[model samples]
Target: DMTQAASTGGMMEMPRASRGQAHLKLAEFAAKQLRGETRVASFSLNGWDTHSRQKRNLGAALERLSGCILALKQGVGPAVWDKTAVVAMTEFGRTVRENGTGGTDHGTGGTMVLAGGAIRGGRVYGRWPGLEEATLYNRRDLMPTGDVREVCAWIMRGITGTGISDLETKVFPGMQMAQDPGFLR
Candidate 1:
């Protein structure tokens, strides 16, 4: 139905011609999982390495990401949206300050965006380490205030009804998930 829906005059234009089709594919895959055809799915968005003119370069990436989110939500429909949880995360972050080349270097501390009817929206649940030069990691990167695994463990524990002990010990070995920043509703 997406091809037919796309034929409507009111549909949004593709942020980037090449990548837009992939967003549609993401929506299709999500629909399959919602219909009990799959248990899980994942997708990747490219072009985060902005080594020059970050304002311009990063916009395209963000737009494509947004496009994917919109397509997924629309494809799933409101009936299934209430049960979904879309977690968008980056493996790592970039430097706090722009580098000499008008871009950022790879560093620690990125973001994880959790969306859908299941998430507790409008709240940024993380310890904020201010932008003071001394507060930065190695004087270049934002200090990582929250453990990524803790968030992961929290989500898994909620979904599986698993105990904290198993989640911390078995699910994530050697990692003790202390703080539970509840992102799930």
Candidate 2:
């Protein structure tokens, strides 16, 4: 469901209808490319940085993201969905409190979303570091409980059938990769 559009300088815009259509077209393209070949693929999206008046910006971004996800589910059908894995993430999170500009400042920690039938669906993964005054990092951001690399290693071994030896020493060095202790199973 990854789609590209003509960039309007730094302000690219695509109508919702067009975006949906692009999703369908891209799905068709992917299916054709993957015909009689591999079952695994990775995709990414960008432009999530919001520093001012983020409510609408965030909602719109998430809406488009969700739409792409649903489109993929429909595009691949049930069998593919059973083996598919979708992981979405941001490089960093922002301050818990809105800034003077109605957005947030750069801060540590954010969230990642995993989708697909291979994943344990309808469940929120990760430990919740409470937003209490002292719990916040630098008194402004959420604390990260899980090392993201551990999550990746777990995914590799459990989902892709990568050997533990490969995952630890070859794929992720100095990671001491452990079994996924979360809901990915």
Candidate 3:
């Protein structure tokens, strides 16, 4: 089964390094989904802890993430890809200003990336808080304009057909999913 999945998922063509291997494994799972062998798959890529020289560090991390996404799409094919939703998130945000080491410290607001054909692709969703000193949270971090939990709740509602009440009470307690952001297609 591993051999069949590897061949079908193009795992042999992937790199042998650990990071690349994670992507290759995700692709294998995606291919299994295509064959009705799985319904959900998830993988994690590390190296986001850029405490110094963030430009170089973050760029490399993004590149790896990009490769992973591309591999998943290719493994699933267009038809299945259209039904998939890829959500990439981090636990914390970075400061708006660069640190002495040219990196950023943890801050109040961060970003979430949603991909695949299932999402409404073109536009950025969330209100932008200007970077002006008056606008920044504590004059250091981007002011969070919306609750991330609400956005996530909406995405879950759309994907799982779960009722808003259940999403509010069960999934994310005290989260008032104000309006449907219409993240799904």
Candidate 4:
């Protein structure tokens, strides 16, 4: 998938096995960490900035992201997977509409994906602010309907049984979290 984008710089080119190798590698590493010594693991994937040619750019990025997620699920195996909760988040959102170059610009109200057997899948969570022009953040990007920190806090609470008091003050200072969205199963 990434081979196409990488070899030709967003065009179909020769197949390259080495293209986007980090996805599966990191996934395998995450799985090993979970199986061995680590309880919480974090890794990152880049190239999400689509300032131009968004379709081609995002296609490869999303493909790699998908592969990484799949690799993580497979590598962790069912036993560990059942208890695992994986999250992938970006720092900010993209513009609501394609720009002059058919790409997106940086803005606010981004998203994160949460996965694991313990998660409540098959649905989109959080309140949506809608695509109407009036609702966009700065009238350009997606307006956040809820606090992202709350989502993370709730996930932490669901996994570690940490209390709201500490989560608000210690883990995430000055956060006033909402009631659980029931992401855990």
Query: Largest TM-score belongs to which candidate?
Result: 4
Tens-place lDDT per residue, model 2, 125-165, is 77798999799988999887776767778876777788877
Q: Which scores better on lDDT, 2 or 3?
A: 3
lDDT of each: 0.72, 0.67, 0.77, 0.80
Q: Which of the two, 1 or 3, has more lDDT?
A: 3
Colliding residue pairs in candidate 3: none
For residues 73-184, could you state the per-residue lDDT of candidate 1 as single tens digits? 7777886677667788888888988888888878887888888776778988888898899998998889998777777778767665789999877888877877567777
**Model 1: runs farther than 4 Å from truth?**
1-20
Q: Candidate 3, residues 88-145: lDDT per residue as tens digits? A: 8887888998899999998988888999889999999889978999999989998988
Clashing pairs in 1: none
For each candidate in turn, the TM-score is 0.82, 0.78, 0.83, 0.87
Ranking by lDDT: 4, 3, 1, 2
Worst 10 residues of 3 by lDDT: 1-10
List the candidate numbers ranked by TM-score, top first.
4, 3, 1, 2
TM-score of 2: 0.78
Better of 1 and 2 by lDDT: 1
The clash number for model 3 is 0
